[model samples]
Target: MRAIQITEFGGPEVLTLADLPEPVAGPGQVLVDVTRAGVNYADTHQAENTYLAASKLPMVPGGEIAGTAGGRRVVGLTADGGGYAEKALALEGALYDIPDGVDDMTALGLIVQGATAWVMLRKSVHLEPGETVVVHAAAGGVGTLAVQLAKAFGAGRVIATASSPEKREFALSLGADVAVDPATPELRKALIEANGGRRVDVVLEMTGGTVTDQSLAALAPFGRLAFYGMASREQPSPISAPSLLRHSTAVVGMWLPHVLTLPGDIMRRAMTELFDLAAAGTLKVVNGGEYALTDARSAHEALRSRKTIGKLVLDPSR
Candidate 1:
C-alpha cells in the first residue's frame, strides 16, 4: 500500500508519498479499503507537530475516512494514523454505515464535520427553536454544516462570520440569515445590527484570540457560546469569569472524540440522524475539492492558506 508520510515536522514540503506494507486488522478493528480521506485543520496541525504529539520519524496524518468495511460502505474516524493510504484500519465502533445515494467524497466530508456540528447543536448547547446563533468560519468544513444544522433545528436567525467576500456569500447561500466579514474590527456591532439590534442566543466560535472576546460581547443575556476550533492561530485571551456571571452567559468546549465514546446505541443514533438529514436534503455537504493521494501536500497547503471552502477530500484510488 502507498501512503503519504511526514518524515519530519515542518511545512507541506515534508509530506512525501511512500510505499508501505499493508496493515492487518486487530481483534476489534476492521480493515477498510479507503476510497476517500477527509483533509482537516487537524491534519495540518499534525503535519507541523503542533497539535498531536510527535510520533516516530515517519507517520501518516489523516484522521477520518469514507470507504468499504467488510463489503459495506461506511464513514468513520481512525484512532491511529494511516488514513492517507489506499487502505487503512478503524476500530469497529468508530465506523458507521453510509446512507444510499451519498458519494464517497460527500460521505467523507460529513463524517468529521457533520458529527461535530450535529453534536454541538443537538447535544452540547441544546439550541432551542427561534433562538439566534452566530457561526464563525461559516464557509469552512464544520462551519458550513453548523449553519445548516442551526437552521434546520429551528434557529430563528443565523449570523455567519467569514474572512472573505466569497466565503460570506457562500455562508449566506448555506442558509445563514446574515453573513459578515470577520476581519472587521466592529464585527460585534455588525452582528447586533444584523440581528435587529439584539444579541444572539448562541455563538458557535471556531476562531479564538480576539474573536473570542468579540463573541462574548455579541451574546445575549444568558446565551451560551460553544467554542470548537481555534483556527485564528492566536494566543487565547484571558476569560473573565466575573463578566460571564454578570451576564449569566456560559462558555462550552466541544470535542467530538469524547462524544463518540458514549454508549454504542447513542453514537449509532446520532450518526443515523445526521445521515437521514442528508438523505432528506435538509443537510448538505459542500465538497471544496478532491485531490489524488499523491497531491496530499497541496491539500495541506490549501487548508492552511484558508483558500478552500467547505470540506476537502483525498481520493486514494486516484
Candidate 2:
C-alpha cells in the first residue's frame, strides 16, 4: 500500500508518499480497502504539529474514510491513522454502511464533518426550532453541514460568516438565511440587522481569535456558543470572565474525538441519526474536490490557503 507519511512536523511539503505494508484489522476492527479519505483541517494541523493534541510523527494524517470493510460498503473514523493509504483498519462500530445514494467521497465527508455538525447542533447546543443561529466559516467542511443542519432543525434564521462573497453565496445556497463577510468591520451589526435585530440564540464558532470575540457580541442572552475549531490558526482572544457572567451566555468547547471515549451510546446514536439524515436527502455532503493519494500535500495546501470550500477527499485508487 502507498501512503502519505509525515516523518516530521512542518508544512505540506513534509508529507511524502511512500510504500507501506497493508494494515491488518484487530479483533474488534475491520480492514477497509480505502476508496476515499476525508481531508480535514485537522490533517493539516497534524502535518504542522499545531493541533490541540500532539500528533505522532511518521504518521498518516487522515481521520475519516469511506470504503469496504468485511465486504460491506462503509464509512468510518480511524483513531490509529493510516487513512491516506489504499488500506486502513477501522473499528467495527466506527464503520457504518454507506447509503444507496451516497458516493464514497460524500460518505467520507459525512463521517467526520457531518458527525461534528450533527452532534453540535443536535446535542451540544440543542438548537430550537424558532431560534436564530450563527455559523462561522460557513463554507468550509463542517460549516457547510452545520448551516444545512441548522435549517433542517427549523432554525428561525441562520446567519453564516465567510471571508469572501463566493463563500457567502455558497452558504446561502446551502440554506443560510443570511451570509455576511466576517472580515467586515461592522460584521456583528450586519448580522444583527439581517436577522431582524435579534441576537443569535446559538453560535457555531469555528474561527477563533478576533472573530470569536465578535461572535460573542452577537449572542442572545442565555445563548450557547459551541467553539469547535480554530480555523484562524491563532491564539484565541482572552475572554473577559466578567462579561460571560454578566451576559449569562455559555461558552462550550467541543472536541469530537473525546466523544469516542465517554458515552459510547451517544456516539452510536449520533452516527445513526447522521446516516439517517444523509439517506433521507435531508443532509447533503458537498465534496469540494478529490485528489490522488500521492497529492496529499497539495490537498493540505488547498485547505490551508482557504482556496477550497466544502469537504476535500483523497482517492486511493488514483
Candidate 3:
C-alpha cells in the first residue's frame, strides 16, 4: 500500500509518500480498501505535533476515510491513523454505511467537519430558533457547513466572516444572511452591524487571538460562544469568570473526539442527519479540491494557506 508517512514532526514538508505493507485488521476492526480520505485542519495540527492529542511517530496522517469494507461502501474514522493510504483499519462500530445517493466525498464530509458543525451548533451552543448566529471562517470546510446548518436550525440571522470578498460571497450563497471581513479594523463593530446593529446570540468561533476577543465582545447578553479551533495559532487574552458573569455570556469549548466518547448516539445521529441532508441536496457539500494520494503535501499547503474553501479530500485510487 502507498501511504503518506511522517517520521518527524514539522510542517507539510514532513508528509512523504512511501510504499508500505498492507495493514491487517485486528479484532473488532475492519480493514478498508480506502478510495478517498478527508483532510482536516486537525490533520495539519497532527502533522506539527500540536494537536489536542499527541500523534505517534512514523504514522500515516489521516483519520477520516471513505472506502469499501467487506464489499460494502462505508465512511468512518480510522482507529489510530491509517487513512492516508490505499488501505486502512477502522473499528466496526466506527464505520457507517453510505446511504444511497450520497457520494464518497459527501459521506466523507460528515465524518469530521460536518459532525463538528452539527455538534457545535446543536450541543455546544444549544442554538435556539430566531437567535442570531455568527460563523467565522465562513468559507472553509466547517464554516461552509455551519453557515447553512445555522439557517436550517432556524437561526434568525447568520453572519459569516471570511478573509476576502469572494469567500464572503461564497458564504452568502450557502445561506449566510450577511458576510463580513474578519480583518475589519473594528471586527466587533462589523460583526454587530452585520447582525443588524445588535450583538450575536451564538457564534461558531475557531480563529484564535484577536478574533476570539472580538467575537466575545460582539456577543449579546446570554449569548454563547462555542470555541472550537485556533486556526491563527495565537492565544487569546485570558477570559475571567467575572467578565462572563457580568455579561451573562458563556464560552463553551467543544472537541469532536471528546463528544464521540460520550455514552450516547450523539455522533451517530449527527452523521446520519448530515448524510441525509447531503444526499437529499438540502445541504451543499463543497468539494474544495481532490488531491492525488501522492500530492498530499499540496493539500496541506493549500489548507495552511487559508485560501481554499470547503472540504479537501485525497483520492487514494489516484
Candidate 4:
C-alpha cells in the first residue's frame, strides 16, 4: 500500500510518500481500501507533535475516511490507525453504511467536520430554535458545516465570522444571517452589531487566539461557548473568572477524538440526520480542492495557510 509516513514530527515536508506494507485489520477491525481522506488542522498539530495528545511517531495523520470494507460501502473514523494511505484499518463497529443516494464527498464531509458540527450543537449545547448562534471560522471546514447545521437545528439568527469578505459571503450563502470580519477592531462589538444588536446565545470558537476573548464578551446572558480548536496556533486570551458569573454564561471545550469515546448512540443519530440532510441537498459543503494522495505535503501547507475554505480531502486514486 502507498502511504505518507512520518517517522519524525516536524513540518509538512516530513510527510513522505513511501510504499508501506498493507495494514491488516486485527480483532474486530476491518481493512478499508481508501477512497477519500479529510484533511484537518489536527494533521498539522500531529505533524508538529503539538496536539493535545502526543502523536505516535511513524504515524498517518488523517483520522476520518470514506471507503469500503468487505465490499460493503462505508465511512469510518480510524482514530490513530493511519488514514493517509491507499488502505486504512477501520473498526468494524465504527463503520457507517453509506446509502446509495449519498456521494462519497458528502459522506466524507459528514464523518469528521460534519459530525463535529452536529454533535456540538445537537448534543453538547442543545441549541434551541430561537437562540442566536455565533460561529467563528465560519467559512472553514467545520465552520461551514456548523453554519448550515445551526440553521437546520433551528437557530434563530446565525452570525458568522471570517477573515475575508469572500469567505464571509460564503458563510451567508450557507444560511448565516450575517457574516462579518473578525479582524476588525472591537470585534465583540462588531459581532454584536452583526447580530442585530443582540448578544450571542451560542458560539463555535475554533481559532482561539484573540477570538476567544472577543466571542466571550459577546455572549448573551446564560449563553454557552463551545471552544473546539486553536487553528491560529496561538494561545487564546484567558477568560476572566468573573465573566462567566457576571452573565450566567458557560464555556465548553471539545476535541473530536475525545468526544468520540463517549459510549453512546449520539454520534449515530446525529450522523444519520446529517446524511439525510446531505442526501436531500440541504447541506452545503465547500469542498476545498482535492489533492493527490502523494501530494500530502502541499495539502498540509494549504490547510495551515488557511487559504482553503470548507473541507479538504485527499483522493488516494488521484
Candidate 5:
C-alpha cells in the first residue's frame, strides 16, 4: 500500500509519500480500499504538532475516506490516522453505507465536516424553527454544511460570517439569508445588522480567540453557542459565568472525536438525513480542488493559506 507519511512534525514538506504493508482488519475493524480521502485543517494541525491530541510520528495523517469493503462501497472514518493511503482500517461502527448516486467526492463531504454540522444542529444545539442562527466561517467545509443545515432545519434567519467578500457570497448561495464580513473591527455591529437588530439564537462558532467573546455577546436570550474548533490557533476569550446567567445564554463545546464515544444513533440519523437531502439534489456538497496523494504538501499549504474553499479531496490513484 502507498501512503503519505509524516516522519516528523513540521511543514507540508514533511508529508512524504512512501510504500507500506497493507493493514489488516482487527477483530472489530474492517479493511477498506480507499478511493477518495478528505483533507482537513486538523490534518495540518496534526502534522504541525499543534492539534488537541498530538499525532504519532511516521503516521498517515487522514482520518476519513470514501471507499469499499467486503464488496460494499462505503464511506467512513479510520480508527487511526491512515486514510491518506490506498487502504486503511476502520471500526465497523465507523463505516457508513454510501447512498445510491452519490460519488466518492460528494460522499467524502459527509465524513467529518458533514457529520459535525449535522450533529451540531440536529443533535447538540437543537436549533428551533423561527429562530435566528449564526454561522462563523460560513464558507468553509463545516460552515457550508452548517449554513444549509440551519435553513433546512427551519431557522427563521441564517446569518453567515466569512473573512472575505467571496466567502460571504458563497455562504449566501448556500441558503444563508444574510452574509457578513467579520474582517472589519465592528464585528458586533455587523452581526447585529445582519440579524435585523436581533440577537442570534444558535451560533456555530469554529474559530477561537476574540471571536469567541464577540459571538457570545451577539447571542439572543436563552441562546446557545456551539464552539467546535479554533482554526485561528489563538486562545479563545473566556466566557464569563455571570454573563451567561445574566443573559440566559449557554455555551457548548464540541470535539468531534469526543462525540464519537457515545451511542451512534444520533449520528446515524444525521447521516441518513444528510444523504437523503443530497440524493434528492436539494443540497449541494461544496467540494474544492482535487489533489494527488503525492501532492499532500501542496494541499496542506492551500488549507493553511486560508484561501481554499470547501472540502479538498485527495485521490491516491491520481
Candidate 6:
C-alpha cells in the first residue's frame, strides 16, 4: 500500500510518499479500501504537531476516509490517522453507509467537516429558530456547511464573513443572508451592521485572535459563540468571568473528537442528516480540489495558503 508518512513534526514538507505494508484492522475495526480521503485544516496542524491533541511521529495524517469495506460503501474516520494510504483501518461503529444518491466526495465531506458544522450548531450551541447567526471563514469547508445549516435550522439571519469578495459571494450562493469581510477595519461593527445594527444571537467562530475578539464583541445579550478552531494560530485575549457576566454572553468551545465521545449518536445522526440533505440537493458540498494520494503535500499547502474554498480530498486510487 502506498501512503504519505510523516517521520518528523513540521510543515507540509514533512509529508512523503512511501510504499508501506497494508494496515490490518484489529478487533472492532475494519480495513477500508481508500478511495477518497478528506483533507482538513486540522490535518495541517496535525502534521506540525500543533493541534489540540499531541500527534505521534512516523504516522499518516488523514482522519476521514470514504471507501469500501467488507464489500460495502462506507465513510468514516480513521481513528489512528492512516487514511492517506491505499487502505486504512476504521472502527466499525464509526462507519456510516454512504447513501446511493451521495457520491464519495460528498460522503467524505460529511465525515469531519460536516459533522463538526452540525454538532457545533445543533449540539454545542443549541441554536434556536429565528436567531441571527454569524459564520466565520464562510467559504471554507465547515463554514460553508455551517452557513447553510444555520439557515436550514431556521436562523432569522445568517451573516457570513470571508477574507475575499469572491469567497463572500460563494458564501452568499449557499444561502448566507449577508457576507462581510472578516479582515475589514471594523469587523465588530461590520458584523453588527450586517445583522441590521443588532448584535447577533449566535456566532460560529473558528479563526481565533482578533476575529474571535471582534466576534465576541458583536454578540447579543444571552447570545452564544461556538469557538471551534484557531485557524489563525494566534491566541485571543482571555475572557474573564466578569466580562462574560457583564455582557450576559456565553462562549462555548467545541472539538468534534471530544463531541464524538459523548453517549449519544451525535456524529451518526449529524452525518445521516448531512448526507440526506446533500442527497436531496438541499445542501451544497463545495470541492476545493482533489489531489492524488502522493500529492498530499500540495493539498496541505493549498489549505494553509487560505486561497482555497470548500472541502479538499485525496484520491488514493490516483
Steric overlap count per candidate: 0, 0, 0, 0, 1, 0
- Largest lDDT belongs to which candidate? 3
Q: Per-residue CA lDDT of candidate 1, range 68-87, in tens? A: 98789988888687799998
**What TM-score would every model get versus the actual structure?**
0.96, 0.96, 0.98, 0.97, 0.97, 0.98
Per-residue accuracy of model 2 over 1-318 as CA lDDT, tens digit each: 888888998989999988988887778788888889999998888888888889887798788888886678988888487889898888776778887877887787777888888889887888889999999898999999999889988999899988899999999999999888888887668777878988778999888887888788878888889998888886667778887887788888899887777665667787777778888888888879999987888998999898689989998888
Worst window of 10 by summed lDDT in candidate 2? 259-268
lDDT per residue (tens digit) for residues 98-214 in model 3: 988888988888788889999999999999999999999999999999998998889999999999999999999999988999988899999998888888899899999999999
lDDT of 6 at 160: 93
Q: On residues 1-318, what C-alpha lDDT tens digit does candidate 4 reach at each position?
A: 888899998989899988889887788778889998878888899999998988887787788888887788899888465888999988666689998988777787788888889889987778999999999889888999999999888999999989898998988888999988888889989988888888889999888778888888899999999988898888877777787899999999887766556788667887888888988888867778789998999999998888789888888886
Q: Cα deviation of 37 in candidate 3 (Å)?
A: 0.6
**Span of 10 residues, lowest total lDDT, candidate 4:** 257-266
lDDT computed for candidate 4: 0.86
lDDT (0-100) at residue 196 of candidate 4? 81
lDDT of 5 by residue, 157-259 (tens): 9999888999988888889998887666877777888888887888899788878778888888899999888889888766678999978999988878776
C-alpha lDDT of candidate 3 relative to the true structure:
0.91
How displaced is residue 210 in candidate 1, in Å?
A: 0.7
Model 5 misplaced regions, further than 4 Å = none
lDDT of 2 at 308: 87
Backbone collision tally, model 5: 1
Model 6: residues with Cα > 4 Å off, grouped in runs: none
